[model samples]
Target chain A: MTNIIWGPMIVLYSFITGLVLGSYIISIAPTLFKMRNLEGISTFSMVTAWGFLLASPIPLVLELGSPLRAPNIYLYPTPSSVMALFGYIWIIFVLLLTTQIIIHSRYRDAAWFQRASTGISAIGLVISLIFGGYFGFIIGSMKAREVWSSTITPITTILSGITAGAALVALLAIITLRKDGLRKDALNSLGKLTLYFLAIYLVFTLIELSTTAYAETLTWTRLSILLIGYLALSFIGVQYILGGLIPIFMLATEKVRTSTIGSIVAFILILAGVYSYKWNLIIGGQQIVEVSPQLYSLLNFMPTQTEILATVGILSLSLFLYVLGLTIFPIPEFKSKR
Target chain B: MSKYLKLQEELPHIVGRYIDKKSAKPKWVMVVDLNRCVGCYACQVSCKMENGTPYEFFRTWVEVIERGKYPYLRRVFLPRLCNHCETPSCVPVCPVGATYKRDDGIVVIDYDRCIGCGYCIQACPYDARFRNPYTGTADKCDYCLHKIEEGEVPSCVINCMGGARIFGDINHPESIVSKMLAEKSVSVIKPETGNSPSVYYIGYEEAVKAGAPVTVINPKIGVVKEI
Candidate 1:
């Protein structure tokens, strides 16, 4: 219940979200472009990919009591600790293997490069599903937190990540389009994906809220806030209505099709909507009070200034790596760049 | 080289050794007689002083629970501590091997290696474990192993003015725990969990049979409900 821990929690969330974003991009990258695309695609893919590799390990390491002691998790595992098990294999299979894909891609169409990216992408998808589900499992397993204790939490969290990844790629597509040349049809494709992900996110959010509203407990004030308080307004109102609907409506408009201020506004909304959704889930989940008298006191606790500064420090690290990743391996645009 | 000659030589040493060492020591276990417990929580206080635990942080805890309806209310006090189970759940779940079950069946934590992840705290079904907020690692009762090593009783048992607690090893044939084990029927907490706890309670089955303080049905359902 120490407020200072929230700083690490933020680091934990942003890293996992970044990892989810990277995994999803790799999964759909092939279909994203038609003609041997190599420009902006490679840039963000490499950036987010390497970002994910670095990001996912940070929380697991920091969460450990003794960093050296962590080796025992893989050595003599309890088997009940599935997260520790999956995390060990995940760090090996997803990040390390994916790096090989980047290495061989430099040869461009060399048999190894194509085979590695395709194979690693497949492995990344599977590992991401397990590792991503684990993030939700940890929250849900807390019997003390009834709102988070539901089995569906893992599913909802997984869905949110995919939705964020798809929306992000769509936004990136819009940004890259503005800088260089563009096909009106490519924008339409991004517009289509943006709409698809929005629908999925909305459905899942509704199902979770509707079910929770019935069997809710007083201990679950955090969930109540996410559903009824100011944050809930953003989650359902901006995220579901304005954030999601506005993008779909703009995509349908003739002005958006022709590329105007309408397109820029829609892209910005998607970005805001996604980031806000992430913030609400991470911060909102922690605000709940456990019913124990011991923990009740912790519920009224406030964050000290040091905690805020630590959070800023963690965010700075993520940002710096992301920028470095962009510089080294820019996403691909068209055929000739490779 | 004759078998009868060698047997004769060994017999004197064996009998002499038995005569010298017999009843020379006592093995100790903590036995709580709950029927005599008044829920004063003096034991909880003594446990704190012995362990020097942080304020509101505990190695041993007690709960006073309500049962039945308002007018028919029955309040019962149950003092809870680490079972120090023969087969401990906390021992294996420690990713760093920080928790270990000793040969004598006491479960102990290696604070130096425990990284404060609180994983073991979550795994304990009896809520026997607590995360030491300052250290961020799991903490729990060790059956007062340090005191036992020093030939002293656990502070809680010594402080129990009602003499509700008895401490001795159940292993020695003539020890008080072994005598009680033979002559009386008693129970270990959550026997169904297969933890094979070292702490024994007299008159528990009677309390349970009367449906007193806590009714842990089928006490063996030690499935992954908590951890």
Candidate 2:
């Protein structure tokens, strides 16, 4: 194993793959909701699945493991294997979702399209929830890292995904809602949805910490590391207090809800909160050692510059891909028409 | 002349009875004599060089810890490796079944099959498994199987300045390890884990500290406690 080569490439691939998949969890809900108000939901689903298809699969091909002896996640998939389940879900759903969306969009006024869109969107939501929950459990299965071993991880990840998806949808709404001259009811309803997801985020965070206390699993050093070093506070700060609470508080009164710039600010803060929440979870969980006397570093564990650069590149690609999707997809046109 | 010839014929058969049973549940074991070990790190260097492990990934390494502060102090050199237990926790949880115990009681890792997901590294209670940053798969001491194939002791055992680590099959009564276990009171690390580890240490209490409490009261955290 010390052997021939295939170290740096694998590490980079793991990092890039993680970034893309982690971000996809956030994109699931909004794409589903874009059915009637924008394109049919199936249209969005096809594009979303295709977007992941474009983004997530490239890294897998670059993996260092022997091509001959490679795991049959794709070809001869084990039914119980999580990765295989996701792969199958993506292929089948994306195809069905895409076909239905295109068909429905062509007949936007038809009764069948409307009902089918709703049904497909609901199915997509379930799939996304599974995707979200599995992402966290993947890390939690690493029993060596006590930080990542918590049962609360799966819930937290799903909560984060839904809330972040809402934020993205809300951002798009700001651009679209303006042209539509959307009244208080639509804004209020959407704002309420965002606030509810934010509340879920808070509950998930609390549950994670509370479980740690009950188990006495987290070391004092690790607890302090999570609190002081990173944006553990910011996850709650921007996502809940400023992004969710303050926006809801202001919108409840009436006049502040009308301020376009204030809504934009809320969008920005929510975006920041969601991104940093994921960043903290990934980076902070890794900072602590899993075993006694440590494994990554007998001396000191630090990420190399190459690893950091590769992470930035993958992140940039994810954002770039999202923008690419928004630019090409017809949903933005619906916003313009509105 | 007839009696002598008969005895010679039976001697090979008697010895062959245990040795030929290589498939018959080989109970791999090691006995460490702390009374003989000085604080020298010869075993650590030899194991590292033999394994070609990257700096931190020690298949077998020695730790010299000082106890009883003051004018009177004692330092003990304890060499550690994968204990190769019968019920290793690291085995079952591996998603790929890359790390597993062979029929011969060896905890072997098939690097070819390892996905380098590092699940096994985290599950090991003894902190024995190391994920080679270079290879991405879990790397560990294999009890120097290559040396055993060559009919020689493991590098650490062969290079031991003090004859501390005695490696052999414990099932055979005539083996050095089996005889040592019979003669000396040997103990495995954290026996309560139910791993039934092969590695045994004599005079462990005298050489090592009365290890971090048995009951795990309050389950103290961040104190650099041994697992």
Candidate 3:
């Protein structure tokens, strides 16, 4: 049996990158769309996005067999390579985001900064969209893997990212914002955004699954085995029932959307759901062995101890950077200033 | 001298008669006669010894596929290696152009340049590539370019006990591969991929039919296992 080449590290890396794009969108939506509901937490969201962005490459580098040679991707880039293009895109996005954060934090009142911020936010939005879909494109382009080779893969990835990102922002906003500083309208808006995006993600996922099932090809057979066989609990039970349906129902109700505890529970579920989606896409896709009728034993693809450590370490690093940013940046007091 | 060396010595006249001078570069191709392959796995053993592929990793291997049931059961040996396609899927996905197709039509990796991200391994339709655990780089069969440059056939071709493998420059119309292509009905794997693989197989349809239950046997221990 051919062992899975890309494993859990790839899944985590994709998830973190999605979060980076999602948080960045939430940060800039206030300025770009003039959504005053997100205004209070805009700077906080940008900082969160920046922190995750800074930490995103850690898992990717750690996953490489020769980590020291990663710079070769930049030096000897093949233009035709989507992965090579991702390197350039990541650098450009990072620079744009950093510049936006600097301007928004330090020079918010300057007329020049405002104009530059608007232009940068517009560009950043496009880049984040690409960044969100980048991992999906990587998987989708591999024609050998039937489950991953779908036109809807990138769209589902972007929607999941937005849902997870909004949930993360909501969860953090509750934790960091002073009780008096917390605005009901902002939380409700974030809850509503998460609900809409999560619902869209669910619809696209169902469409992808149904389309795969509709075909009489080997794809459906393998996917059916995946859905009802070994991965049933993770793919259907957790990802759909607990993470997807429960959260959607919770967020849809005003009683749950307006309450701190209820919204927090829903956001946490959304985050878990998104992570499960990435897990299913990366690990579950690899489980369907192309050459053989038998699925690759999931036991083979379980993250090694080193992989698990690296995932935890990188997640901790992202959280550390976020906390550090909170301490270092002079984020204006949201209640009084905004 | 090997038969390939003898053929190489006669290449000038062959090229003069068959190939245009401007396009005379050797385009290597392999033709596997499934009819002749007896599942001896001499090629698989020789490849391991020659290339020093890491444990549990293969540069070339044969898959033993059994079809039908009970009285009608039959086994087919499907020998697999890199197709070294005219348009390779693995080539364009490399973040660092560490893997590329040579003008001679062999797909090769620059080991020193590879970061071992395994993207090429994932992109390959045939599962022909692997990340070398010891070297920490992507490695695969390159038609044994080192041997070929010295006017020798790949180790696998030379060691195939059943004479099932034919390796030659298709650019020379007089080459064995050209004659075989002209004489036999052949098929390439995953033609829908648009990779234009250089490797050709006789009896490909019967041996590699989709949904055929496959069993990979380890030649070393003669163990039958489903992979």
Candidate 4:
């Protein structure tokens, strides 16, 4: 029997990594572009990215059949392997982020440090963009799974990541920013960014699905399974309706965008939508068996209790670290001069 | 000297006696005659016993592909294993350089070095590789390398009751595999993958194309009752 090798753990890892990449972009973009509205949450976004980044690899390590042997990726580097590139990319990105955070916190007034931080932020932005779309490349390179082997997968991933990242930063900004410090325009900017990205993601997804359906190739059967079969609820219902349409509708309206509770609900739904999209991409991709026309039994796709616990546990640890970081680090007030 | 070291020293001489000296390196290949496969799964059972493959995992297995309908119904036994392709998709995608092709043309996994990332597993279009539960490493048929080094055929080849499985060095022009490949019309599974698989089948297209809704029978339980 064919089993789904990369399951819920992989889905969780991909989702978290997307968030880390997206948040890193949100953290660095304001200073680089000099967006006044986003500047207030720049440092806070960097801290948030750091928290998620630290915990991102946990699920991946835990998912490995031999966790201790993970270091072998670096030890016996396969230069040709796309997966081998992850270690190098991740380490470089982490170092860049750390240096930028340290410079901003400790050497904020130093002329050299300011220049250094800006240089680092520019480099980090490119790396974050790569990191955001890298997971999609991992899935895209797998020529076997038709659903994931599309050229558009990486673009969709980056767009969805940006959408989720903007939502998360907006949510946190609303919760943490003082009444005097908080900017309605800043939240509105984030909302507008999210709407645009989410719209693009939907368009790209529609193009992919429509083309696959029209092709009538071997991929069509698999696409059918995702569209109207076992994964239909998760793919269409959660990813599109609850996650995509509801949030887009809510964010589109000025009343909901300005209201505190309305924005919170929309952001939460967008996060859920992004998570569901990842789940469908990773877990759903593996559901189709290679040799047979038959899809893998639904029973095989269910995550084990350990997998559920590990996913929840890792997320909890990341949130804890983020909270602790906010308290430990001296984050300058939103209105403080740069 | 260690047994492996001693064996390594003696191996060339042992193989040289049986294999032609003109062909310095043996390019191993298998030819599966689908017409001769009797659906007896002796290769499947012997493979498990020989390799100690984990339950629900296989180094080699027989797939019963049901073709046609009504009076014309036929079950084609397609024996599946790692093709050890000329350009293996699994090799390039391995994060750790654990899986590689030997000079003699066998794709083997270095278990000690494998980190079990499952990237190679995903890259392989054949669905040949699997995670060895015991070793926590990628495992697949290596043409039974230990047996080959000692101048013996793979367990699947020797145990195949129908004599459908043929293993030999294609580099040697006189080898049975080379002769069959030259004389008979043979095909490889999923040639579209561009893996250029070493395992060639004699009647693949006719058997596979004459069907729809292909289902895989469990290799362990060889029984499939006629509908």
Candidate 5:
């Protein structure tokens, strides 16, 4: 009998890492690009990235059969595996984000600190881009799983991160800082940006599906399981229709883009869509059951009680840390700046 | 007897004189004669008893493929296990180097070192590896290494009802595996994967072609029998 090796925890890890990367990319807007309208949410998004980054590896550790032995990946790393690079990459990210957050909070008024923060942000920008896309590269490198083994996978992951990141920042701005003069114009601009990234993600997904349809041998069977088999409802309904198309339509119209409830609905849909994509890609790829040369079956995998509880616990911890960061740090007051 | 048979009998005697010295390492290989396999599943049962592998998880298993229509129906038994490849895909992907190949070409896992990340399980194209729920490490066929170390044949080889499985050192010219390699044409599964599998098959063309996507053959289309 065939059993699934990777579970929903892997999907959660990938999704959370993408959010950290995407949020960091959004944070770069005001610091590097000098987008004044984005300046209010810039520091807030950086804190979001930090909160999510701290929570990111928790899922990976929980998923391991032996959590203590995880450090062995660093101690006896094999160069051929991309997973081996994770230890070093994660440490570097922690150092850089810590320095960036310290500089922004302590010395925003000092010229030297401003210059130093800019330099650090530039480096942070480069690291975020690589780490964000590398999440996709991790799966894309697995040549055995045809649905995940695509050049488009990494690019799609990075784009989806940006879409999710923008939605998150918009959601936070509306919810927490709405009375602080976080304006409709700023949220509208962010909405427009989210719409564009969401559109590109949809296009990349289409291209991925089209090319996958022609894959030979075992890959063809995998794709068949995805498109026509058990995953059909989530793949078609939740991902394409509710997540992609509806959000795009809502964000396309100016009235809905500017309206508070409309923008919230669109961002929420984008988040759901991206999360669904991660689930379908990582978990769906492992669900293809090949018993022998001629025999193939599909195994059903849903998050168990332990898995769901662990995921929810990690995310709730991240949200708690984010709120703590907001209170302790000097996040720019939207109304004071206005 | 053939010249090779004479050599097979005499070589052990010649080698006995050098008992003080370390003997040559065996480069193990197995040959599965598809023509002789009778779908008895004795190998499957013997392997499980030998390994004590958990229920529903097998170190080796039997797969039966039914082909063609009612009057022309054919049932083929394909015994499946790890290829123990020369370049096993599962080896490099192991983050902790827990899985490695031996000097004699047997792929093994260091149970103590495996972190049970399950990467190797997915890397294998043959569907040969599995996550052992008990140990939480990757597990697969090792060609009955423990039994071989005791100078005994693999359980499946000895227990095979059809006498289909042949095991020996392929590097020795007089060995049964080597002789069969010279005398009979053989094929390996998924040759395009470039794994250079050691297990060779005879009359596996139909079995190889059966990899095309499975379809629902109508119940009335194939040969039917009442229980």
Candidate 6:
């Protein structure tokens, strides 16, 4: 068996990609779904999504041994490689997002712009969804990694993205706007939506675990590592308890769902939980001992200090971009009628 | 002509080997005789020396599986390396086309072209590939390409104490490997993966079917350690 190759940066990249997709999904509620309550944070979510989308590839590039040769993905793309599609997908997403944001911010009054923005927003939404699924496909296509080789992986990942994305919108709505922010009804609605996604995410997580339990092949070794081995703490504690149950209870209760502090706490847990899920999936899948005669032992694969710092640095830069975006873009007033 | 030293004038007849170009290119194959293996890992050591692989990594490794309890106990030495598969799973998964099959059927990675994304490493069912920490590229056993070019055996083949490692071109009708394949039963590892590995094992059915759990025996203390 080989030592662990992928580090924390890869995990961070997947989490950040989900955020990009999730934020875009939240932005869709107002523009495409035409939910009036969601209108308050539609522009905010779009800008945030763009910030995350732009930052998504930075971690990937940083993780590469030869970052300069990354363009080879486009230069000599193998048709069968799912990772090769990353270049084209990122470009398409950026272009559609740029057009959609411009139409919404600059020409909100023009009927033609509204129609165009709606169409463009729909396209952006589809791209974001596929972008979310693309992260899943990247790992799921690796048939050798038994823990990740399943069709349900894509579905579970998309659901997890939705949960995190909706929670981000709700958290931002509460924190930025405060008392004079979005209506009580809108906040509560967001709370309920986040809860539903979290529930479904939990179900998919169970299904993933259960399927692994029944496998008769060497894949069962991976399942044992996840459940009873070193990874059990992260899977059961951080993901299920801190991320899942606690947040579900918080959002399910009407009093907490309606309260700003309570909802923020819940959203924070949701984000932690979802990120932990990704951490477990990416890192855990790779940590399994390859079939070796010396009795393959799992490595204590932790990211280096440099890798940790780089991850934090990229996230900080992404946040900085989001803050800069909020300043430059004149996002419509929260819940204000046009 | 200008009183220059001519080294050619000093040396006598040292006839070089003549390889026929008219014959078809030889398709290389390795046959591991499981019955002869002693699980000493001499080949593993020689391979690392030949390749200069990192400390934590291996170009070829030995798996010594211990099966059953006390009275019925048995051990199997399973030396593993890159299958050099015909339909290698790692080939297409490489985003930059760094990994490809040669005309002679060896699966090789071009270090110059590999971006070190480690995709092919994960795609391999045998866990034969690795991201070399020093080079930052995907690496695996290429059946000792340098030695093959020199018309010599692989380092592992030369080092095997039990004479379990056999390397030859299976395409040649007169080759020992071709004779063994025709006369004896052999099997490849993880054939269900559909990788069609070129490496075959003689008398491997029992060990392969056992799927026994193994433990590491600390070389110094000779203590069996559980992981």
> How does model 6 fare in lDDT?
0.80
Model 6 misplacement above 4 A: A217-224, A290-296, A334-338, B1-23, B211-227
Ranked by lDDT from best down, the candidates are 3, 6, 4, 5, 1, 2
**Candidate DockQ scores, in order:** 0.15, 0.18, 0.44, 0.41, 0.33, 0.42
Candidate 2 lDDT over B1-112, as tens digits, reads: 6989999877744443123323244577778888788857788788889888886457876655445546666666667778999888777765455677876678988886
True contacts kept of each: 0.23, 0.09, 0.61, 0.55, 0.48, 0.58
TM-score of 5: 0.89
Give candidate 5's error at residue B111 in angstroms. 1.2
The runs of at least 3 residues in candidate 4 whose Cα sits more than 4 Å from the true structure, single-residue gaps closed, are A112-114, A178-180, A218-220, A293-299, A334-338, B1-22, B211-227
lDDT of 1 by residue, A1-338 (tens): 12222334443554355445533554435634332333335445445545555655555555554556566566655555544565575666555545644664455557676666666656666666666566666655655344455666677667666655555554555564456555565555555555666566667766766676566533344454666765667777777666777776876665684474666677667656655655555455444433222122112224357655654555467556655655565344523443
Docking class of 5: acceptable
- For residues A1-338, could you state the per-residue lDDT of candidate 3 as single tens digits? 36777888889999998898888889988889998899889988998988898888877887788999999988897888887877788889888877777788788888797788889989999999998888888887778677788878888899989888888888988988845477888988988888998999999988877776676344444666557877788899878988899999999998898898999899998898899989988888887665544423232356788888888888899999988887777676443643
List per-model TM-scores for chain B: 0.76, 0.80, 0.84, 0.85, 0.82, 0.84
Q: What local lDDT does model 3 show for residue B226?
A: 43
True contacts kept of 3: 0.61
lDDT to native, each model:
0.58, 0.57, 0.82, 0.80, 0.79, 0.80
Query: Considering only N, C-alpha and C atoms within 3 Å, which residue pairs clash in candidate 2?
Result: A35-A41, A43-A101, A144-B122
> Candidate 2 or 5, higher TM-score?
5
Where does candidate 5 clash, by residue pair? none
Candidate 1 per-residue C-alpha lDDT over B8-36 given as tens digits, one digit per residue, 9 for 90 to 100 = 87764443211121234433466788777
Location of the lowest summed lDDT over 10 successive residues in candidate 5 chain B = B218-227
Query: Which residue pairs of candidate 4 clash?
Result: none
After aligning candidate 2 to the native by TM-score, how far in Å is the CA of A257 from where it should be?
6.0
Off by over 4 Å in 3: A217-220, A292-299, A334-338, B1-24, B209-227
Candidate 4 CAPRI classification by DockQ = acceptable
Candidate 2 residues A128-241, lDDT tens each? Answer: 556556656655655545667788887777676666555554555566446655444545444555566667776787688778757877766566655554444654565456
Candidate 4, residue B47: the lDDT equals 89
Of candidate 6 chain A, the 10-residue stretch with the lowest lDDT total is A289-298
